[model samples]
Target: MELQQMRYVVAVAETNSFTRAAELCLVVQSALSQQIARLERELGARLFERTSRRVRLTPAGAAFLATARQCLQAADRAVAEVAAAVGEVRGRLAVGLISTVAAVDIPGALREFHQVHPSVRISLRGTASEELVEQVREGTIDVAFLGLPTTARPEGVHARELAHDRHVAVVAPDHPLAGERAVGLRRLAAETFVDLPAGTAGRMQTDQAFAAAGLDRDVAFEVTNADLLARMVREGLGAAMLPSAYVPQLTGVVTIEVTDAPARVEYVIWSRSGPTPAAAAFLALLGIPAS
Candidate 1:
């Protein structure tokens, strides 16, 4: 069987949906299905039991899945090893990060990488922490920089921390409690807050902290951009709880330390299996050790 067919098998098995697997492999659904069918016919057994609602592996398919994965992994390693031997980093590198991430100087790092490896084509995408994690896990992006809550860690990925800081509350200078050294969630129950929308990692972190403190405050404004949130606070729109680095943009807003707030950790994450040569070179340029 060809390596591409083996790759198709592993992808289908992992996702459990032919359509999704085809999308992940960057191929047409019909072609992928026909190739897998051809492999099954050659093996003289039905590998997958397909129903209308779901796709599942038959006994033979289950037994062959492990070998299929191994073959794909081996092929990947073989290519990586040869690329390493060639000592030329010239390929596509896809990197994802959150918009509010200030832990690493991404622009500066990219500039340096371009100077060092001019032949490499670099692509960068700014997105939310949850989305970044999903992209890295799926190998759509070679690496991602993520800001994670204290209680959260990415699964099935290799992560390297670049920075760590704590969350703080910000409000207009004339707002009540602006001069306080530190504030607690219990004292802010009646206040309206400006924050990120639900489902984002930053929002999830703050929500968990509020839930743990047994306080439910009103979110008066929801913004995805850090500068916009800071502007909302500066304009007396509302108060907000945000990461330390994202606070300085609130020029006129007063930042009050949040007591017992969850710590925010920034991490450089990649697929656990391996990183492409271009990705490895970019990581090295950023001073992150090889995974």
Candidate 2:
């Protein structure tokens, strides 16, 4: 019932060990267990099923965990908001970005944010654009940078386009197409390709381009990392099409313009409901007006 009790329950649930949870909470194991027991008695439901070997959340505990987390987040946000009113921003900022993000210098931005709001905690993660969008909606990520095909836009979130650029063909220095000034999708389709996995946002842009051109390309290498994709091209394993802005960062590959290439849009997205104080400050630093 009490917030302290909920905190203990959450810690136990996350660690799955009463001893570890006590350590995390900076309290004795017996004290943490006693508080949880008291909470369970008040709720008339056993929150966890504990055995000699391990501790697991019971059905009732699983049902209550989500709301407990939301409540805790709300309480923390309330405190942070009050602190912000007094000219101090104190909260956690979780930022997500696609692996190929080039529109914004995330490291520089984080450095400035830290200097301005030294008390705020920040974390960054890189993944696919779609997964980042999902994380923002789920409240795990406060803000994100995304890249998607020009024809596609993020749904169910607030988004602002940052930049747009066409993809260029990259090949080994000695490859047949390396000396070409420009080529079309059809020309690239004839060569084996190295790209992100199928069904991902990064791969979709290239895939849609090929599909629209009535071409079927062979993707011999599927890699999640952009550097590895460039490596594959450098070793003559396959050719690749990557955003123009990101190409300069890779070495040992020849970049050629694609005359009829797919264009990708870079966007900054946040929760539609609103942004946390730390996220709002970050957006402001990026010159995006508050929504």
Candidate 3:
């Protein structure tokens, strides 16, 4: 069967109305129905059960629908790959990032990439590190910048450390420990803290460090955005632990070294297989050496 026939089948299955599917496919209803009929004849299976009330998929059609969609997607991907190989970068690149990212200079890199591959389209999404990792695994995003523990490597993902900055304690400029160059983790254990929610890479690193030190912090607030976390610290809401880059330098918040906290590492993560040409170009823009 032709790819157009598969598209017609998928369109009918998704819309559930031959008339509507025809409209969506930019074809007349009779032509769409004829194509579907021809596909069923070729396969020697009744793909749809017709009734006056609604168009429904038969058992055979139900089973074939998923496979048809996959075939369409694969065909589209193959075409895109060939086009990118012979022409300028001109495909969609879905990119993911954590809200607290301050490393890798994504904006700068995108600016440079745009100059070279103006036809390429970049779609960016910001979320938690865990969600970003999941998106990468599921192929929702082609590549992402994620916060990961120094030694924790996730399965089925290719990751490269893009940048690393020591985790630091941020406090109000007038706080008692603000004058010190560095302070131990235990010193802040008794103080109320503002931090990222649990399971996030930032929070995970802090928790691991505290666990290693046999100390527990009094977390008074949880925030996902680093700017909001910084605001909380500047407002004297609580002390915070964050990567040095995430803390705004010109703001009233003061960043000091946490003597025992490990460095927060930003990794460029992608699926182990099936990277699009746009993704490869984007990675190169991010300065990841070609493998």
Candidate 4:
């Protein structure tokens, strides 16, 4: 009639003693007896033949005992399989990254994550800060190394800041500004810019920094990828304003300090809950110190 009733029936059948089965189950004999009586009444069958001296199963009781034991065993196996799925530290890690983060950090983290979890398959996606946030929210990716100030503040996500990306100005290796150790926002106003898209917070900061000095930029070109921006600058395109990490060592591009540029921080994020085992491991991987 119920799982507890089935368990009681099986236990009594196994031990051949109501008193011993009750002891085995840590329940009083009278409680076990009453429950068995209720189960028998519910099934409309007498499950045991009781005497003052002994208790023995009816023919129906023997048949039911075997089925009940199998049912309990199956329940155990199901529970164990579910526990292993939720708790195992191996599986696929679907990771998304802002394009610039991939340029700087993903390679090292990818190598380390593989070393620690060889069986885990890593799926990587490259996109912008806003796009990466949406991917995490929609369950298209398990985790992301996305740039911050995600416009939507997507529901059901958790984030951890790995590093703050300080802004740096990049120019051709032989450009006159390249000789300067550090350049000010006012000086940048005269130079045409290769900037991030107009709608980005990065662009806003770039604008505000110069505005503070009673100056404004004439953005000559606009593009999203920092690596691409570096290549453009190397080919004598307009100077790019972005983080040093993204343009570390382009062949013909030189990065210089921007006196009062804003920092664009990066984060490694995961689902607030329901992170697959591998996703959890990957988030842990992000926190690992660089080797």
**Per-candidate count of clashing residue pairs (backbone under 3 Å):** 0, 0, 0, 0
Residues 6-92, candidate 3, lDDT per residue (tens digit)?
Answer: 989988988889999999999999999999999999999999998888988999999998788668756756776888878867777
Each candidate structure's TM-score, on Cα atoms with residue i matched to residue i, is: 0.71, 0.89, 0.75, 0.62
Clashing pairs in 3: none
Candidate 2 accuracy as lDDT? 0.92
Candidate 2 Cα misplacement greater than 4 A, ranges: 9-22, 46-59
User: What is residue 232's positional error in candidate 3, in angstroms?
Assistant: 1.4
Candidates, ranked, TM-score: 2, 3, 1, 4
Higher-scoring candidate on lDDT, 2 or 4 = 2
What lDDT tens digits, residue by residue, belong to model 1 across residues 1-291?
Answer: 888888888888889999999999999999999999999988999889999999999999998887886676556556655767788776667899886787888888989999988877789998888898888876768889889887888778899887888888888999988989998888766789898888799788888888888889899789987888888888888888888886764588898998878678888998887777878888888888865
Residue 73 lDDT in candidate 2: 74
Please give the distance, in angstroms, between residue 172's alpha carbon in candidate 2 and its true position after superposition: 2.3
Q: Which candidate achieves the best TM-score against the true structure?
A: 2
- The count of residue-pair clashes in candidate 2 stands at 0
Question: Which regions of candidate 3 deviate over 4 angstroms?
Answer: 1-73, 248-250
Ranking of predictions according to lDDT: 2, 1, 3, 4
Q: What is the C-alpha RMSD of each candidate to the true structure, in Å?
A: 5.5, 2.3, 5.4, 19.1
| Number of the top-ranking candidate, with lDDT as the measure | 2
lDDT score at residue 56, model 4, on the 0-100 scale? 96
Residues 207-234 of candidate 2 have per-residue lDDT tens digits of 9989998999999899997988998899
Q: Which stretches of candidate 1 lie over 4 Å from their true place?
A: 1-84
- 84: Cα error in model 3, Å: 1.9
Displacement of residue 2 (Cα, Å) in model 1 is 12
